[model samples]
Target: MAKKPYSNEADYVIVGAGSAGCALAGRLAEAGKQVILIEAGGPDTSIMFKRPGMITMIHSEPKLKKKFDWGYYLSPQEHVNNRRLVATRGKVMGGSGSVNGMIYVRGNKENFDSWEAEGNKGWGYADVLKSYKRMEDWQGPDSELRGKGGPIKVLENPDICDAAKTFIEAGASALGVPVNPDYNGASQDGMHVIQENTSNAIRFSSSRGYLTEQELPTLEVQQRGTVSRVVIEGSRATGVEVIEEGGQRRIVKARTEVILAAGAFGSPQILMLSGIGPAEHLRGHGIDVVADLPVGDNLHDHLFMPMTFAMDNSPHHSSAFYFGKALLKDRFKPGSNFLAHSVFEAGAFLHTSLSQSTAPDMQLFAIPWSYPPFQDDPVRLSPDKRPSLSAFSTLIRPKSRGTVRLASADPLAAPIIDPKLLSEPDDLKVLLEGVEMIRAIMADSAIAKHVKEEYEPGPGYTGDKLRAEVIKRVSTVYHPVGSVRMGVDERAVVDPELKVRGIDGLRVADASIMPTIIGGNTNAPSMMIGDMAGAIVLGTGL
Candidate 1:
């Protein structure tokens, strides 16, 4: 590993240079406060990080994925055939924002309003929307609901495939919903073309938008360093103990604050490692307790099952030759690539029959290309050569919950993650309904014309057999949240202001603080949390 002189002190020390970390660091530095952002992974240099088409390939190849992904595995889930599902999180400079599908969604408005209703003040839809607009620079259709000039560049996907468009239209007709031009505006329901946080064709991750693009002289980024624990003294966070890439230990001091933006999994794991979790769990690990809050409880994620079809007519710009050409030119000229935007360019939100809130219960994604089937053995996939189109059924709100505990006290050791997916009967029931809804849309005349055959769950599958197949195929959409939840309740790890309950000068700004998981992709919401953190710390209103 190459070595550089690392900074030992700053006004603010932020662990994890992910979506939230980068945004918060940028804002604080712009306010003339010296900030140090620490990242566990190296710099983001892979071509796969810049080209949107290469994201699917990264998921397919294990060796390529390990280059930037944490590649954590959940403990065996009994309800879903005791399968140990794979959880992919970006370990690079921008974190998951650099490696994700690049889909931009603010989730449902109700998701935020419910936070206020649950006793988290100043966190309602109206309050959070100001932060969203403050950070976003939307290039989509003109609307008062959308923001124009901000750091994060969000634009409508211009490369929607014919197959995806057809699927959206057919689904809208089958579900009696309109083809909404911008789901991020007005309402979040109906079939719609989604947006991406991209400038031209290159992905504009938080590192790019906030760190690299901004002119902040006071911000210093420390990469390839693992934060072992927060250094707390007298019920106040003063700094962090880090293991550098060269295997040297050092303590970095923060004069004002220490913030953890290490995503849902990493934040709680770091908290437990710092001896700030449940009293029994910390004592069992032989660590002195700092706080006895439920730091790792309420772990939940969205469940997804994909339905694929072999297309008789090939979708234009989906061939191997075009992908190769796009990869070569996409780095220099942005939109020249056929896969300029994300592969999952269009999706829909629908209220299932069992929806308990005003928000939609399920979200669907349309993919013009076929991906490899899910398998636990080897956990590596080979891309299918056949021309195909896939629709994903995602249960956004699940009743099932689990926990994140220490595999051991080692900071570098992987955390024991048990999402306990499909543990609740209602979760399986709603996921089944989502799968059937996709099947109904595919059976329609508009989309059936392109279908050669039903690939995964076979056309003959029905009733009990179909239910069994859903169990076999169900997996994570990779949108995990609510691990280190924020609230006014006793179990909450962080307060409404993102401050740790019993620890001063410490805060959490990431997906982990979501009181409840949002109803859409988590990357955008996580960045919004970072934006809000900066405002709160600076005492500036959005």
Candidate 2:
């Protein structure tokens, strides 16, 4: 059969050209299947998108956020001081992968094993490991655990600061554990340097790795296009109706499948707009129900409380100064600056007393600067001018869940998002334990030498007061997932193969399909999901 001309149709129509969408489209196209990848945002051609070090700047600057981020705000949480936290999701071509911290964490093996245990067959670590290895082109030395000659290029943080190194050493000393050379490898516990999707001093985003790096004759990318809804006829998804920037709407037919790779929030929003969520909710929105399944339940995310320390008599300058230097260097040298090192270079995954499983419940990030002096959004404040060290204690396995619902039937309107952070008592307990551990690590001899004084969440607070401070300061680590989950039971929106329940030729191939939030940064896993989703659709999945 001859290939169809690139028009308003294709073999596969993937919405959202982000981390997962890019990979899924690339895979299908490489296999000779015509694909159309649609992105709401423009291309990933900005300098801010290319530089590895620009992440800190991106979060700190509101103008940049306006251009790159979805700018969604979670509802005020009753558990965490009623604070309305901002959810920073990428709106660009590469999605969050282009604007995130760039840390590449594959999550714990137990994360996947548990998914399979929950009747989601073939999702165990062993099955997904093949996908991870298949998507990675690691710069690390030869190892069967890691891979080479893959789509995404992975590299270690270059020019790691002295403070980050000391923090890693201090973590090992405080925990009485050896520094694990690779957390993404055999073990996820202990201190280690984080690897990211970066190479040759540039960010290797999913758009760059999969869409731009290779030529796929069968793939077509449509930018500045927002998907309004999945076009369904009876019980089958035929294609999608997309709204262009000029308010023009058109339908792009999908001959085989319509895959939603639009992240956690967007995927659910699109589904509900297409009348495929809870029946009551769809009726309230004036939309007819196609499926009465849970489309937006089980929303969960990681929360981190930052601990900053004043650096006295430090060897390195302020991160702000280095950022400025890098900016100037970019004008002359280009891609040859210290900004290549993502801010949180070294980290540790440790288990708290509250942890029920062997996998660590908390994660700590070491920053070489005084980051966000206040508890508000990092976008509101620039890096402190003074030299400082900061470590963030993150609740990796949060139990609290929330929901995503359609604010209205309007496709342009943002969805209502609520992760209900720290609602579970044990989640707060794990976070408190993480704070204690971070305080201990700061006291270690390796890191104590540079410390001047405890900064924000300052000294003399303990017990109730400390808990209050924790409530006041804890914020999202920008990892939100599990809204449109995959499983075999009642709450599952998608099945083992990521096919939506009660819908034919419709699948979800992004973080939204995760039944349980993985115990690490979700970018890598989302990409793997996209990669393997293509295989599953092609009848080649493990």
Candidate 3:
């Protein structure tokens, strides 16, 4: 059969049904608007996407993630021995939120305050807190800070392995901080259970929370609708050109506005494809220049280096066995099914003497299990059972920046992603301190008896050797941002209101627009940006 023509029009044409697109489309539909949410990837109903424990399978097998993962590769990082790393962005409906390790971190309060201090008026913590509340359906304990009764239910991952008990216990004892139950509550400065995007063991992704919860006649979705470019007329973005699943190319017009929620890498790639990037580069690609604002420049992402310790313990069970138990033994229970939620091992944040900032420069991730990332990946340690409890000190505020450039004019071709990790000399120093801090956290006496030995850099590694180990073992925590950064400055791609600079009837609301990477996970904050964008389009005070 010949391909059916795509819908040519909608009041709002939103690109990429990732976290931001789903949230924005839902909000627009709620207000009775015709919205088109186009996704390049497939749906999220498969068995692989549901079971959280299958993450091991989803990760170990590249083919399993290919359907939902963009799976982009980075250019040789000069900092990490010129090694290329895989940057995983979700290609499916729920986007990365559906595939990620459901760690719902709201970032440090100072991260947003820094955004406001950088000339973004409405982006301060006080300004976006209400918007954050509007998007969250938090079911956790009573707290004045966390939102209540909204979409996207938040809960602590109940499937935490027995090793997490040691992680939290040791973290609280060593760091001199209490084992705070709610990290999203009063403050985000202590060791706590990993808050997740699931109510039970079931992953409640943004797509599940916003798009799949209810069907509205106002909202329409075109899965596998790969967008080629935003069709620009004069200075306005009037529509988008896309190649549908069955090799049919069509234009989806926007009557009022066109929004780009295609995430950090994708949003920039689409902009450059539409001739809204560096003029000289667009000419090189034989494309007419629409707006020559620095589109792909100023890219940055959070980096984490882990330190795993071999453990002699076991409380492991097959997910199939637990899923069966959940179906039979614990019927009709809300959070009883351990197989339903992501394996949220435990997490924390720490400070080093090198940083005088109020907010911690180094973030820590303590996991009960470990997968050896490198032979001497001191970051990733393991046991004979490979049941190792690990601590990862993620660099929250990174100074090094990179770029995203078009590899080819073809819409299907992947963009060149160069996240110049640890490019700055100070970045190395901060992370070096972070590694040492994790060693200290693990060295706490409260739970010191169960350890065997430090595998990498055990007795001799020092100074430059230690720094090299930290650099070589580093990998992206899967948080990329700032390619299409927002601000009021000359270099800003979008204004504080998320309006793309030098273009009308076009806006970008996603993690891409963040002026800087937030101190925590980007999923919740990206949804907040989408909610704010909806308010901006409707002329409501955000």
Model 3 Cα lDDT, one tens digit per residue, 1-542: 99664577999999988888998999999899999889998888875566554455555455765666886878889888887777878888888877788788887788899999999988898878888787788877666677888788887776576667776888788778778777676667778788888765567777988888867789888888888999988899999999877788889999999999999899999999999988998888888898988899889988877666776552543244443555563346544544576655688876666667777777777666554555322212333344466677788888999999999898899999998989898888888887776666667775576666555445355688888788788888788899998888888999988888889999998999999888788888888888888888887776
Off by over 4 Å in 3: 1-6, 317-338, 375-384, 456-460
User: Considering summed lDDT, which 10 consecutive residues are worst modelled in model 3?
Assistant: 375-384
lDDT of 1 by residue, 1-542 (tens): 88678889999999998888888998899999999999998887666777666776666566767877887998999898999888888898999998889889998999999999999998899988898888899987677788878899998887787787788888988888888888888788899887889886678888888888889999989988999999999899999999987789999999999999998899999999898998898898888899998998999999888887887654634445667776677657766755577888678999899998889999999887775567553245544567888788899989999999988888889999998998899998898898889988888877889888888777777888988988998888888898999999886999889999999999999999988899999999988999899999999877
Question: All candidates' lDDT scores?
Answer: 0.86, 0.87, 0.79
Worst 10 residues of 2 by lDDT: 313-322
lDDT of 2: 0.87
Clashing pairs in 1: none
lDDT of 1: 0.86
Total clashing pairs for each candidate: 0, 0, 4
Better of 2 and 3 by TM-score: 2
Worst 10 residues of 1 by lDDT: 375-384
Model 2: how far residue 71 lies from native, Å? 1.3
